[model samples]
Target: MTQTPDETASDAGSQLLDAALMHVPFDGWSDTAFRAAIEDTGIAPAVARGLFPRGAIDLAAAFHRRGDDAMVTALQQHDLSTMRFRDQVTLAVRLRLEAVEDKEAVRRGATLFALPMHAAEGARLVWGTADRIWTALGDTSRDINWYTKRATLSGVYSSTVLYWLGDDSLEHQATWAFLDRRIGDVMQIEKTKAQLRKAPGLSSVLKRADSLLSRVKAPKSKHSNLPGGWTVPR
Candidate 1:
């Protein structure tokens, strides 16, 4: 059977990316590496540009997404039935970083996204990864908690990736230790929030707040093209 146009394009993009990976460490995710990959793959120039309009930037984005896909697949196979919620989340972040085949590729992509113009895109990718992890863990949040969960995990995942990249300890033990500390900090914040919610003076105030926030639903998967989804109280 003939491949659909989108499928064909995806195949070409994967080919280009696989070839590009060989050159990425040497040249970073730059135009030179992209061009060399095109040559290596023998994919036409127009087709390559059509597939990656922003050239190497798009390639870097694709790479990050590929890692996210791998992490999700790994999460599906894990036996998380016995772990605490915190350990489950920590394992998710750990698997994400472990999915990377080359730390230097991430280092290069990080530098690229650090530029003012690309920072937003970089952030979006990080949030996307965090979103995938939460979804894989069977998160059922539908209100403001949806956004908050992803936002909080994004921070933890991003910091852990940075630490992991620089870590030289055996099997990156130090990075895992650092990740545990960050997760502990987030858990403490959550504990405080739980206490505040139950406090006599704050209970009524927070209940009112939660009523308003409940109107802010999770973006439906079909309508996710929008940044967010919500319903205003009449």
Candidate 2:
């Protein structure tokens, strides 16, 4: 069976990521870890280099993407349709968080992204994770509302991850409490937005933003429906 380009990349990423993970705690997410991973793969150095030209950053992004992909699969076991939207969101986040057993590795990744020069990369990573979680939860939004929802969720997930990193309580009880508070904040914001939408003269601005997205980006894939389950006008 011939693998498509995406399949092949996914395969390489998985292999390299598994190998690199063993070295992360000691070597950090630097070339040292990639070299160790490459050596473990027994692949030519050039091939491993090609797989991740930017080295650790590429690997880090791939690592998160791998987790995000797995999160989608893990969510399948739960009947999200039976839950309310808030419950679905909570479960989806928990499922994603549960996928990582290497708490130290997550800590390292967080440190890596926190570098001053990597600010944009860190933002992208947060946005990507939030986008994946929302998509995995059946978000079908479009337009500016799409961006706003993901932006809101990025705040939630990123803050939760930060909180989780330092959490040592049994079962991460503190982190979950933090998550619930953040989710509550989101619900409150939604309620406020609902009231704002009721005020006159804002409809035209939102409609234009939605129209702009369709013109500039259109639909790209199953996970490409912008992001977030904003209640857009049909």
Candidate 3:
């Protein structure tokens, strides 16, 4: 069987990444690690550079996305039938962290992404992870809630990861406790939102807001007409 260009590129990138991981802990996703991966994989320098144009930054992104992919696969295999929605979310986040093969690699990636030039990329990766988790957990929100849900979970996941990195408790129990508290805080906000939805004067205001936001639809995979305005009455 012949391989497509994309397939070939993907295989090359994965190979390079696998080799690069060996050096990331010491090199912190720097050019040195990328160069070493090229040498280790015996891939053509041009091809490796083509696969990762920005070098280590792209490798770091691939590493994060690979973890997300693993999390999605794990979520699909798990039985969440009896779990509360909050517990499901917590488990998804935990599964994401558990997908990592090496904590030091993550620490190095975190340091690389924390640089000013890469901060936006870091945020994008974090948001992507949150989006993946929500999608895997069967989130059907099509309104403003779609954005809000991911944004809120992004904060939770990022904070939990940072806490987990520093946590030395048995099995990172402290981090899980911290995650539960954060989720509890979010649930409390949700409770307050439900209360506001039933309030006297505030109810009307929120209703109008919800009405406007209801028209905002989630984007389809192919072509997206998101934030579509002024839907014609049926």
User: Which ranges in model 3 have alpha carbons more than 4 Å from their true place?
Assistant: 222-234
Return whichever of 2 and 3 wins on TM-score.
Answer: 3
- In Å, residue 97's CA in model 1 sits off its true spot by 0.6
Candidate 1 per-residue lDDT over residues 1-234, each given as its tens digit: 999999999999999999999999999999999999999999999999999999999999999999999999998899999999999999999999999999999999999899999999999999999999999999998888999999999999989988888899999999999999999999999999999999999999999998988888888883468766779778
Residues 27-53 of candidate 2: C-alpha lDDT, one tens digit per residue = 888889998998898777777778888
**Per-model TM against the reference:** 0.95, 0.82, 0.92
Q: Candidate 3 at residue 39, lDDT? A: 99
C-alpha RMSD (angstroms) for model 3: 2.2
Model 2 scores worst on lDDT over the 10 consecutive residues at 225-234
- Quantify all predictions' global Cα lDDT against the true fold: 0.94, 0.80, 0.90
RMSD (CA, Å), each prediction: 1.4, 4.9, 2.2
Could you give me the TM-score of model 1 versus the true structure?
0.95
Task: Quote the RMSD, in angstroms, for model 1.
Answer: 1.4
Q: What is the lDDT of residue 90 in candidate 2?
A: 79
Tally clashes: model 1: 0
